[model samples]
Target: MNERMTKQPKAIQAIIFDLDGVLTDTAWYHYRAWKALADELAVPFTEQDNEQLKGVDRLNSLRWIAQKGGLALSTAEEARLMAQKNAHYLELIQHMSPADLYPGVQPLFAAIKAKGWKIGLASASKNAAFVLDRLGIAGDFNYVADANQVQNSKPDPEVFLLAASGLGVAPAHCIGVEDAVAGIEAICAAGMRPVGIGEPARLVQASLVVPQIAALSIAQLQALA
Candidate 1:
């Protein structure tokens, strides 16, 4: 865990979500793309190392891979590798369908809607909109903010702030869910409640942590809020 549990406020007028892990398991696709590129660059990549890339931008992820291999590339080379990795990722996601959405996602969204709260996305993936479209849930969100829409990346809170702004909700009236440490930090920095969708040890920064999205319930959310 990167942090201890923290205090938070009440009320959730909107729920902001991270795309890759929270909405679906596209993190695996990301890992495969990065791993393939790492092999071509002779960089040692592992699942453990892939954890570090979660909620990070493509160019930064490539830079980390390059640093691992002790290689310093020109700007043109970096661009080539980033493009190659994105191509692989796009190919992998071509197989995605509505069934690719994680369990309980729709249910949770329904519950949030039933409660009259808004839904928003605050992901670091530039392909967040594309992925949501592939999953056939693009119309479900009231707002979506991703890497392409933000000047800064995870741990900066820019995307979350943007999402809250787009949802027309105050930060304290929103709940941000994520599965990455950096993402949890961003949620906290955004002044929103953080609900982690992973092991508590790996996401202690969140006040409300669950083993999976399926473990979430309207009752639990109500209590948290």
Candidate 2:
């Protein structure tokens, strides 16, 4: 087990969230978009392929799909495919309004904010702003670090660190909530507490693990800080 897993802190001043699996159910949307592009290109991909792309930026995700299928796409081809995928994603997301907010997300955001702790978003997706805006929760965050703003993605700690810096908070005073192994690793690398939103066994490196956002309470967060 990682050292963070051995103990939980009792106070936190900031909370950074991963946008895809943690904040919304849009992971499936991304999966479908990528899968469709793979099929159109005559590339083989499965749900398992989607797993490898988790927490990676869109361009990286497309490149992974092509590489895994032994397809060498030219820069132009790659751009076209990425554009196609984004178009499909935008259409799919149009149906998502504030009413589509995930279970416990609203209450969790409100509860945390009420405690006067800063809130930030750290996502691998460049379209994070659009997603959050469509969900009507864009204003909830005080800072956002998306793929376009960072040179490195998850497992590099750039995005998380950027969010911490943007929020004017030290990494040690922040808690990162993520659902991917890469995201957890990034949070740890940034020297912040990590809360995994999945099976605890799967997130054995996280300082705290919850099955879902609903499982986290303001009091529990305070106690863990």
Candidate 3:
């Protein structure tokens, strides 16, 4: 189905968002936590390696780090490592406030809700609910489909599909905004319009690539959808 370049739908009834890099800047905390673990293990994890973790699950990211360190782990060991990383990340984000929301995020959310568009959050993080609550914006979304609710992560299309279903909107009638390659692919594969929120080159597959969500408008989004 050449999902990489699908046609936009005539209307966008729902806007599904990825939590970390999109609505908040928790990606930095994820990277810092991973980096701390890698350092403790004497692994050569760099910022570039962290980039590869975007839209990927916590355990998978740990696995990738282990692969870089040339280590194989038992299931229990992997679970321990995953828990360690998550604990570090959770600690880092415990101090987050609504001030952590990206510029224009609240206004954009308000504008979208004002237009009666359903908002859904589709994030790989199990802490998505906590983050939203801490930001005091938990009520902003119509529904949330996080890692706990999905068996698969981004690039599998499961999360986005679930978000669309939760929003009671057809996939074709939803627009997904993401900042990672896997997320954009998931949106496309889910048969929804993909709106990239980062580098244009990295998200050339999206229906519309913008520098940030603040740069997008309801009219622009509708037209793209």
Candidate 4:
């Protein structure tokens, strides 16, 4: 584990989290869903394609698929394809429950709540509710801002900003936790500090990066505020 420290400060008012890779090991679910759709359309898609779509919303992923397949899809067609992919993902995640919650997630969430910070889910997935329900952590968050609410996704800051606005917190007082480089960029652009949960080298723009939430503590996080 890598260790770097920030000076401690007053308690944070709110915390926003990215759902997929950060809160659950479902990034591969998205990758497989996209790949299945590509196969159905006879389009070539590699892991690199999925990587490019990281932190992008489902509609954008469907648009990318249409673009790469050279298939001109009308808005209706695009929506249909997106619906198909989400159905597949939902089925695949049907067995997921609180048992699938990442190591240390429950404890960390309880700790933060005890400290009086409002929690919010800020995911790029249009199926954010589905995943949250699967993990059985839906009740932990005061607000959830999924792809449906944002006009622009990560690397654009709209999603994160929306989450903060919905939580009635200033962006500067909110700390965004994410796992993708694009997510880190969005958090920074929203004028919030970002704590990245993945390989530190993969999260270059994060204010602080840790291997996982397991490595973070309430005190350590408060320091970033």
Per-candidate clashes come to 0, 5, 0, 0
User: Which runs of model 3 end up more than 4 angstroms from their true locations?
Assistant: 1-9
Tens digit of per-residue lDDT, candidate 2, span 46-142: 8887888889887788888888889898999989998999998888887887876778999999998889999999999989999999899999999
Question: lDDT tens digits, residues 1-225, model 1?
Answer: 334335454667998999888989987889999999999988889998998998889988988989889999999999998999999999999989999999999998999999999999998998888899999999999999999988899999999999999999999999899999999999999999899999999899998999989999888877777
- Give per-residue CA lDDT, model 3, range 31-129, as digits (tens): 899999999888998888989999999878888889999988899999988899889999999999999988888888888998889999999999999
Worst 10 residues of 4 by lDDT: 1-10
- Report the alpha-carbon TM-score of model 1 versus the true structure: 0.94
The TM-score of predicted model 4 comes to 0.89
**lDDT, model 4, position 99:** 78
Clashing pairs in 3: none
User: What RMSD does model 2 have?
Assistant: 4.1
Q: By lDDT, rank the candidates, best first.
A: 1, 3, 2, 4
Candidate 1 clashes between residue pairs 3 or more apart in a chain or in different chains: none
Q: Indicate whether candidate 2 or candidate 4 has the larger lDDT.
A: 2
User: What lDDT, from 0 to 1, does candidate 3 have?
Assistant: 0.90
By summed lDDT, the worst window of 10 consecutive residues in model 1 runs over: 1-10
Residue runs of model 2 more than 4 Å from their true location after superposition? 1-11
Q: Give the 10-residue window scoring lowest on summed lDDT in candidate 3.
A: 3-12
lDDT of 4 by residue, 36-107 (tens): 999999999988888888798887788888888889898888888888998898888888888777899989
